[model samples]
Target: MQYSVLGTTGVKVSKICLGTATFGVAPTAQDADRIVGAAIDLGINFVDTADVYGNMPVFDRPGAPAAADREPAEQILGRTLRGRRDRMVIATKSNGIVGLDINDRGLSRRHVIRQVETSLRRLETDYIDLYYAHDPDPDTPMEQTLAAYDDLIRQGKIRYVGLSNHPAWQVTHALWIADDRRQQAPVAAQVKYNLIDRSAERELGPACDRFGLSIIPYAPLHGGLLADLRVLDREVSGDQRFQGSGFSESEIATAREVERLSRAWGLAPYQTSLAWLLSRPAVASAIVGAETVDELHANATAADVELEPAQLASLTALADQPPAFQHRAGDGPERPPATTSSDPTA
Candidate 1:
């Protein structure tokens, strides 16, 4: 498998990150073991999970058919990575906002501190390679967030930090806070980027490029849209992704066009889509979720399939239309202010 540097953190990550969102859910721990084994066999050294990954709370109730309230995925991950934790770069996320109370949800110092210990205990690891704030905390100030991350880094709880589903401006501000506070800054950003969803192309890509932050794109297959050929016919198979995505008819046509290009290029649609994502220098890793061992094998093998320039161009032309807000985020640029009382530079 091919590897890439995870932003400024200097960690060499596999181009395809193994996503465990499907782990320990629907499928048992044994099924997860098989998938993990396949990923490792393919030389995938990066694994991504979250504190609330498998806790599928249906109908807005906390009591879902999950393994447990906390430490479910981590326990399985630790058990699976018995002799290979050092060789792999492990990452997990927090701030899922499941509870009804306010303190249970944001990137506050208390929440971060509370969760870090819990995660460490669950994973049975001393330090996490990467810890991400799963979502933006609108109520918490940037300085407070940075301060919490700073403490974690100082205490050696988390080695590196990242943000997911956050806007470019928020990342910019977070970095500014890290700079001013003389703390560890987030070296990566995660967003939904794939053949079906190129929304990150406009703002996130450019912002990460400017800030020296790497992009770890999740939903790399548009939630099985490009992977499953049935999506070409504008039909979804009872997946939550379809319920929330609100994909338009035009988007469906574009996906079919992408499928057509895949045929012309003599590659699978998922392979072409992943290869296209790998073509971008800003993307460090593409997180792929696979439910079964066979699916994991198929998705992991896409890294070996390289597309020619002509093929890349054809695929781009087929599905490169920018959305309504592409130029807005790119055009409005700002330098975040320093966040300390005593400025270092005179």
Candidate 2:
């Protein structure tokens, strides 16, 4: 595995960050152990989990077996990471539905602080290397959230602040406040960025560039659509990973073409898709999740795949064509050609 500095954070992490959404959702405790063990064995030291990523939700459904444990992802990681926590950068998020209580969710001052404590307890770690606001909370003031994060930093509860599923304008405003208020600035952001959805490139991409923040894209494979377009035939429309969205016929065809094009380039569709994503500017890491070590290894090894300039340009040109639905596109800087600085660290 190749390592890259996580956006402005001095700490270096693997290009392929291991996402733990599958911990209790898919894999058994033994399976989770092997997957994490395989990741560490492969030099992937970045592991991402969420406070809400428990067995409560499985395969996009909310009805997990009552016998399953809560916060299984973190609990499992805490158990599996014994004597090895120092070697990895552990990231987890809050602001999602973790309970039925009124204060169980959101990025409010009370919730952020409360959730971090719970997260720390579950992970069996005192300090989170990176803690993210899972999503924006319109109910709470941004200042309240930022101030809470500031407190966490001072207390050494978390080292870096990041956000996910935030709009570009909101992120920009938060950055401005952090700088003007003299608070610890956010070091990274996450968004749904993939070959099929370049919407993030329009605003979040450029915004991160201006703020010197890293963009960690989740769902690089569009929740298995790009992994294998054939999965679409299964008709499992509500796979939670797709975020309540499904690909159109045209989108499927486009994904198929991308997969076919990859073989001509001597790579799997997933590998080619990941390589293209990693080559883009502003990307610090691509978070991929899997139930088994073999599946994880297939996606993680894309770090070794590189496309020639011409091949990359060809792929970009193909993607430039409008997709089935009006995919989000807006004014922003053009993505620079892939280069050595894709994950540059100082």
C-alpha TM-score for every candidate: 0.86, 0.87
- Please identify model 1 stretches exceeding 4 Å from their true place: 58-71, 98-100, 231-247, 324-346
Per-residue C-alpha lDDT of model 1 across residues 1-346, encoded as one tens digit per residue: 9998998977899999988764565345666767777788899999998776655443122222433443366677877887777877999988776466868767789898888887888777889999998877656676787788888888999999998877777777777667876888899998878766678877778999988899999888777767756754543322453224445676667667777888887777788888888887599889987767777778877888888898878777766564532322322342344435523332
Which pairs clash inside model 2?
A: none
lDDT of 1 at 289: 79
The count of backbone overlaps in candidate 2 is 0
Clashing pairs in 1: none
lDDT (10s digit) by residue, model 2, range 164-234: 87777667767766776789888889887888777787777878888888989888887777776676765
Model 2: how far is 169 from its true place, Å? 1.1
Worst 10 contiguous positions by lDDT, candidate 1: 58-67
